[model samples]
Target: MDSIDLEVLKTAAAWLNAGHRCELVTVIKTWGSSPRPPGAMLAIREGGEIVGSVSGGCIEDDLIASVARDGVSQTAPFLLDYGISADQARRFGLPCGGTIQLAIEPLSGASGLPELLARLGRGETVERRIDLKTGAVTLRGASADSTLHVDGDTLATVHGPRWRLFIIGAGQLSRFLAQVASAMDYRVTVCDPREEYRMGWDLPGVELVHCMPDDLVLEAQLDARSAVVALTHDPKLDDLALMEALKSDAFYVGAIGSRANNAKRRERLKLFDVTEAQLARLHGPVGIYIGSKTPAEIAISILAELTAVKNAVPAELLVPHATAAPMSVAGCVIP
Candidate 1:
């Protein structure tokens, strides 16, 4: 699953290529408790068709109304606002007097959206600058080697598919995790040297590899934005890959095992000269303590933890509701 912004851009490109008149709306600023953040986008097609969102339904209704009345004849970009007043906030269902500012621009040849999509498809980040006054747009290529400039004020940068995941075992759990991760726009790879595990694997959008798990980890050149998860219980398969992963810049490195097994695994890693500092980075009892049981529920817990780390959200903020008790099965608390 691509991000909502990328999806919006792709949808807009499709509509534009089909000769349908459409306008792109981007949220440039927000106040109070707006539903969407800056850079949030929505594409409003002719005849009130829409893709993506800028608010909680009310603002979309307003945009649809505008499209029905004005069509896409306007060339100049327009700044639109909603929920500026208490009454307006209540009318739009924005809690506690929230407000959002949007820049509406008509797409054309000069926008270079199709070219931008092409570059993004190649795993490159690009910056799109829109003139608030004239609706003119400029596209610039960006990478680790490129510098970004926005007048005297450097605008926020947008990225394409940069997140990656390397799964150690190609089991049933790996299949579920791979599908969920792909929907989150991660380029996923499953590595398993055992023929038993590799023979029946049949998931789309995931790369299946028969190379040694540890070698595959090194080949991927795990970076700060990448993640590694070991699903196999075998120490020979999981330990080598995890040892290399802990040495890399991967932000999240985890393994699936019971609490006692996790402790035993850590003890085993001590023999390999791994320091306590590096060992601390491992999330052995992987996932938040959600008390999940089934493989599907366990997958959700793991994804939730990964997303929390990615977004830098505090764990305290994610405490379960007071009314819900922890889930347990067969004397094992699955978290």
Candidate 2:
């Protein structure tokens, strides 16, 4: 599923290219239990067709009503506010004290949206800056660390997939993981030196490569936004990669195996001069342990764990806490 914000941009671009008028609405500010965060976008066409969301359904409903009544004009972008008072909040279906500030602007050639989409397609992280008074837009290459910034009548939002996943296998499990991760806006690359296993691999938004896992890991320059998951289960392939990945700054490093195999893998890594701290960073028997028994289910569990880590969830709240009963994903019965 395309995230609502990205889908909004793509739909607006399509409408613009098709010679239809469309307006882009972004949530630039919020307070007191807002329905969406800053930088959330919604696109509305001249004909009242809409995509994406800035609030719960009620907010979108109000936006559509505005378009239908006022029509999306070619004037400069302006800010709008909702739920400013108790009566207004009740009418807009917002929480008692919630408020949302929006930046709504018409899309056109000067918006640089097509170019922005092109850069995103090339896997480049981009920053789109909009001048609130002039309705002008500019696109620039951004560092992986850049985030959305709104200040002083200007809005700068990051676009494109900012996260990367390096999967050290092209097996069935890797396919599901890759597909789901891609949907979550991760640029995934699958590496496997085994030609037999690499055959018939076909998935969009994922790169397939015939390379040793260790070499790929070293070359990846895995930063905090990156992740490494080894699903090959082959010691020669997975161990070297894990050793490199765990020592790097990647936010998550994991390998799939049973509890016994994971324990053995840790013991074996110690001979390679892998330090205690680095070894502790390894997530073995990888996933949140939600009783996954199939490849698809396993993919879900891994994503859940990865998400928890990404969101900085506390240890006590993370699924299958370190002190809880251990479960193996290697065909173990839940009982």
- Find the candidate with the highest TM-score and give its number: 2
The candidate 1 region of ten consecutive residues with least summed lDDT is 321-330
TM-score of 2: 0.92
Across 1-335, the per-residue lDDT of candidate 1 in tens digits comes to 46677788899899988988898888878899999877778999999999999988998998899889888755777677888899999998888999888878888766678888888776567777766566666777654423323343223335465588899998878888888887676778999999998997887657899999999989989887799999888999999899999989988989877666778888988888777998988886777757667777767777887888788887577642111244452245433
What does candidate 2's lDDT look like per residue over 18-72, in tens digits?
9999999888788888888887888999879999888888889988998899988
Per-candidate local distance difference test: 0.78, 0.86
Looking at model 1, the pairs that clash are: 1-183
Alpha carbon lDDT at 93, candidate 1: 80
In terms of lDDT, the best-performing candidate is: 2
Candidate 2 residue spans exceeding 4 A from truth = 1-3, 321-335
Cand. 2 Cα-lDDT: 0.86
